[model samples]
Target: MKHALIFRVVLGLILSSCLSSCGMAFRSEWKKAPVTSGVEGKWQGTWLSDENGHHGELRCVVAAPISRKLAVQKFFYHATWKTILSGSYEAMHTVQKQKDGTYTFKGEHKMPDWAGGLYHYEGTIKGDEFKANYKCAMDHGTYVMKRVR
Candidate 1:
């Protein structure tokens, strides 16, 4: 009788544990993904340093259109800074598309004998404006670029 009682208790505990753990699994409502934004154009904006709020004008042209395949996109990014530094660099990076229609990428910038460092960028497009957050080795900043042809 004692053995049967212990077995019942153990089974009850096991069932309760299983039921409790089932709730821990991820569960979310299914929703349609947003349309991908275009990143092909000439963009001009300002890079505001997060360290000291010092800003610089930045112009970039995404020479190629973002790839729309299932895999991450590889795009050509060329940019020039006017204030904090005066130079231009070209880089090709793979950017991922988010469900919210934004893009995120990480790459290194090397401008010959000029500045070089690692950077992570996240940007969103709305109408003709492109806003992005840049975090580099020395400083982090937000840039707002307007589509110019």
Candidate 2:
């Protein structure tokens, strides 16, 4: 009887624990922020840095035409700060909106070692500019984002 009681108690405890987290499942509804404002639209801008003198143009779209959480983007540039300097560098990136109004931009490129890899941005969208904390696998950079599009 005691063994049976213990088994039932354990099973109940397990069931309760599982049920408690079922409510915590990640749903966009539970996203960190809502009200899609600022940071959405055609954006034409430049990337500048002190680490190395490089200039680049970026075009980005938020709340893309066909999908949610997808950012359509294109960037073309001359990176004099790169380890190897030569022709203009270009790459396409996709941005995905997180519930918190922040975004994740990723692409394949041969630029600064610190500029590649999974990049994450925490954005403050105000007016035509977006200020974000840009993070890469090996480095962190501050972006003074401007909107031109």
Predicted model with the maximum TM-score? 1
Candidate 1 displacement at residue 147 in angstroms: 0.6
Please provide, for model 1 over 56-136, each residue's C-alpha lDDT reduced to its tens digit, 9 standing for 90 to 100: 666665544355563333333332333322333345555555787665554444422212246666666665687777776
Model 1 residue runs over 4 Å out of place are 1-37, 66-85, 96-116
**Top candidate by lDDT:** 1
Q: Compute each candidate's TM-score over C-alphas.
A: 0.53, 0.37
Clash count, candidate 2 = 1
1-149: candidate 2 lDDT, tens digit per residue: 54564354345434543554422322221233223445455444545543333444433334423344456454332222233222233345565656865655555454333234455555455566665455555445555555543
Please estimate how well model 1 matches the true structure, expressed as its whole-model Cα lDDT.
0.51
Question: lDDT for every model?
Answer: 0.51, 0.44
| TM-score of candidate 2 relative to the true fold | 0.37
What is the lDDT, from 0 to 100, of the residue 35 in candidate 2? 31
Q: What range of 10 consecutive residues in model 2 has the weakest lDDT sum?
A: 77-86
RMSD of every prediction: 22.9, 20.2
